[model samples]
Target: MSDKAYDDRNNLGGRVRRYARVGGSVGGLAARLAGDRLFGMKIDRDDHAMELAQALGNLKGPVMKVAQILSTIPDALPKEYAQELAQLQAAAPSMGWTFVKRRMRTELGEGWRDRFASFDREASAAASLGQVHKATDTAGHALAVKLQYPDMGAAVEADLNQLDWMLSLFRRYDKSVDTSQIREELAERLREELDYALEARHIALYRHMLADEPTVHVPAVYPDLSAGRLLTMEWLDGTPLMRFTDADQETRNTIARNLFRAWYVPFHRYGVIHGDPHLGNYAARDDLSINLLDFGCVRVFPPRFCGGVIDLYKALRDGDEALAVAAYEAWGFHNLSRELVETLNIWASFLYSPLMEDKPRLINPADNPGQYGAETATKVHKKLKELGPVTPPREFVFMDRAALGLGGVFLRLGATLNWHQLFHDIVGDFSVEALAARQNQALAAAGMEGTVDGR
Candidate 1:
């Protein structure tokens, strides 16, 4: 079907139905909050947060995913709300076999069943936006077929409107962070995720970027069996990363090291990152190699932004205030007051601290991995509140998310390594020009030319 056909399907009626369905829950919550404010009634924030989570949980879609993302970002939402929403899982109730059959017919053709040697009636895995089924191709290769939920375009538009309202409500109550850019960034990435064709390109991009890294694996996409709302790929067999926590220290460390390479190598080498590091997004083989999955939430950064990341690390390590300011400027931060810079450095130093140390050590020996950056985030949020609201550059959203998410994983595995050496191994010879060239070549090779900054 053409893009216009898809758009026509998700017309005004679809959007209105979605809004009514989602708003029934979220709108009620909004009303309650507004009532509390108007009546000057004391609110039990924790209770309301729980109610909010329950509401979003029941209506799984982009809003629920946004809640999960917000929970990880410090001060993105109230502490109570973040804690409650953090418990929101990616798994949602899967569409029934009847719906799957119809969707397959729509995406492929009436003879879709003939293309597959066999296809499971049940979903192998289900998430907010889509569900995956185990299948075998005509060539007898094991494949994972991802089918997007119906009306997702309409669902995304409605959810984004609801998200904007929720953020606005929070802003009215607290002004620690200006979430306007954050919303825009999330909306863009979420919209991109709806296109499985783009995700196919992302898979190619990762395969090319990590081709030299034997420890990391990227799945091969089957274009013939895929569509805008459906993706077919080589199915990888592995154990979830969380299951390896109790394994021998060596095994655990190996997994952690491989995971670190899987995530960071692409970022440092090509100015790209797997934005979402949720545990479910990857797994580990018996040989300790990593299988990176879910290419939906990928971010491509400008070469200069990648350079700024390294510059900020060095600035913090060497106490170079001048270079630090320049790095912030490169990252799109404007009008950085001495106080604001100092405040921002607090969070940056915390993230970069694990990498600055020269000796082998756990990522954060002092704190529980679950509460990895909560304390520091609270401190930073307090300072920002006092300093007035600051709009973090959109790129900061996933960059920070990747750091904190991976840090939590490293802490969980108790991976002891000279992080400084590991980091230097990648960026020791880094240059903006070199990175730009490599990024362009890799992107073009993957059919993603001119996507980021128009090259």
Candidate 2:
């Protein structure tokens, strides 16, 4: 190992420092609740949120990850905490050269330097879980090397405990939604991301699935050079998604159309969905094509679940209550009382409203620019409160998150299209049995388990 290379941040001393830093801040916030038993001196949730963000920002791994999770699940965090955590998704600190050298040695062994024609010392990009470095192979092919931060598994488990406490606090503020299932889902997906071998196969699966898609691209994984923590893939040169915001309407619309296909084609045609949508996961080429990056958070659902999504859309569009209830059941939602069903429909209506409208329009039709589905979310929250604590089925977590994240993307592009037509173009030939066959073949070929977290 190189000198002081690959710092053992997951070691006892390191973990203690991490926990102490966060616990000290959180402990102060929890003093009243701890002493008085959930209610005494009031905790300023917003202030507590800022302190938590500060604590996470100071640390390397867990806080940003937990923040990313809270950002996805609706009402999982208070607005203040969510916003703070959301920022951390893009602003993770990078590991220094010594750490990088040690990581490369571990992944590629002593002769790692000779394998690359050139490797940049500075990271091209960094996130909570890992950092990417630009490199060139001996044959001159550009590559992106993503190195997982050391001891991420340990840090993740430790921080997930803290996340539990954070969510408990959130539940105190809003008892409408029981978040235990959602937490389990987050933990499952986050742990899955640690397995780069699985992700490499996800890349292969996408390559096979999207072969005919002219507007979408998935990188080629280097299996020989990749380990459980390190992934090497062909570098995609493209502009960031937001860089197109100032582009012409036609260009923006084309980009949005491509994004729509890139995201949904796999879901409708197969039972897979890319679970993360943090904007950084995709980029736009000169012709407005998309480069799909990051396969770590892929979710492969049962074909029935995929069919249920469309069924719910059709039910909402046609106002078929019976179909809607069946679809809910298919999605694994238990005993849906009339009021709860009505509340869920309100939220579903917002998601499906775009496809119902035959005319071209903005995704978020509110008069003022707002968070996509903000009003709908608020209304649903109010209704859920009235209806009492509701357990959200596991499948709903990432599905809902990806939907809102994509809508936010469209709103940013200011794209206008007959969303109804676009949606139909994809869903017109949907078949449950066919998707089941396709999903099974894909899973078998990729050597992946059929269930997402044994669900």
Candidate 3:
């Protein structure tokens, strides 16, 4: 093997084993403790869950990021697991100056210092696979330099394998949700996220799509300084999305409006969805506009698929089971049997409830189904248990993650608005022929196969 590949493999192998060992041990302990003296009690469960979360957080890799994502999706984990995994969303500890210097030297070579006017030795934010540093360009523009942690690609793959093992253990512990489909989807999304080049492209596409939308802001990427492993963009300042929760109702509504646009504009207009809708991926600006961050988990759909979503919503609103089934088939769920379709509709109806209603729908913190956030998720899991393994269509994966993830954020915000109105405005001009034309145009523009015409 080449020297570079050898180094990547060896370094990653060490981190993976460390994480698996730590996670496995914690899972075992938590299982035993739950079974013994403190099973099901709130405090005991909380303590046990928190201990596992901290262990994974300290590991600070794909394992931690996966845990954080799973935490947001109800029924993906128990209440305590979800609560504990929430802690992983906080800023990770940054690497020391010595390590940062080494990374720079490795990626930019020894003369990298001459390329920038100034580069901060310290990181502003440390995430799962990388950290962001504030830097100044020679042209006098402020920039955010995203430096990938060394050997992270391999580490991510390794961590995913370990996560698979942990999830199996989880399934045995709690058979509420069949997480295999979820895990596979997450693995693909996370792998794409690790590729910074893909992230740069996603960011650029979003910038172009959101240009006319004033309330939503996506950073302008500096392509000259970006590489497969590194990304640099204009630095943006904003508060976390959570801060808006305590603001006045009007202010909160304004923020939510921008958020609604920020999320749906791309999906409806361009067939691309920002797959990771965690609170950390968005920021609340002082001007009431929202700042969109992290393009790692973006999903691109065909225009036809986008239309399929609308068709399904309309079908559910009108109680047209035939049309609804057709929409699901269009979405690639060929195995959606009659009984399964009914159960699936229970969930789809809930998701489309906000848009189906004339007035605003309030999703208060108290109204939260809590651990059973998605009734369909529970029903589907039960069905899967009875019927055996169901091969989920690939296209369904990322969109589901994005939908649930975004819904979780809205739940946290507790901001109510006329969701149906905004949704309608996005796809007001929807047409099958027009959608097909646009889908082909986008595919040709991106130099990708044009087969994704909502098949």
> In terms of TM-score, which candidate is strongest?
1
Model 3 stretches with alpha carbons more than 4 Å out: 1-12, 15-27, 30-48, 72-80, 170-179, 363-392, 439-455
* Candidate 2 per-residue lDDT over residues 1-455, each given as its tens digit: 54343553346655666567667766565554443335566566676667766766767775576676666566775565565555554457798998888898877899999999999999998877899999999999999999998777766677777778867866776788889988898888888888888889899889878989999999998877788689999999998887888889999999999989998888999878888775678899988899998888888887788889999998997889988999998888887988888989998998888999899998876553325666677778788889889888888888988787778778878899889999899889898988887877777777765544332
* Candidate 3 lDDT (Cα, 0 to 1): 0.73
Off by over 4 Å in 1: 1-9, 35-39, 366-368
The C-alpha TM-scores of every prediction are 0.96, 0.92, 0.86
By TM-score, is 2 or 3 better?
Answer: 2
In angstroms, give how far residue 208 of model 1 lies from its true place.
Answer: 0.4
- Model 3: lowest-lDDT 10 consecutive positions: 1-10
Q: For all the candidates, what are their Cα RMSDs to the real structure?
A: 2.4, 2.7, 4.0
Model 1, span 162-268: residue lDDT tens: 88888887788788789998899999999999989999999999999999999999999999999878999999998888898888999988998888889889999
lDDT of 3 by residue, 128-212 (tens): 7789999988998889999876667677777777777767766765564567777887888888877787787677677777889
The superposed Cα distance between candidate 3 and the true structure at residue 166, in angstroms, equals 2.2
- Rank order by lDDT, top first? 1, 2, 3
Model 2 residue 169 distance off true place after TM-score fit, in angstroms: 2.7
Deviation in angstroms for 321 in model 1?
0.5
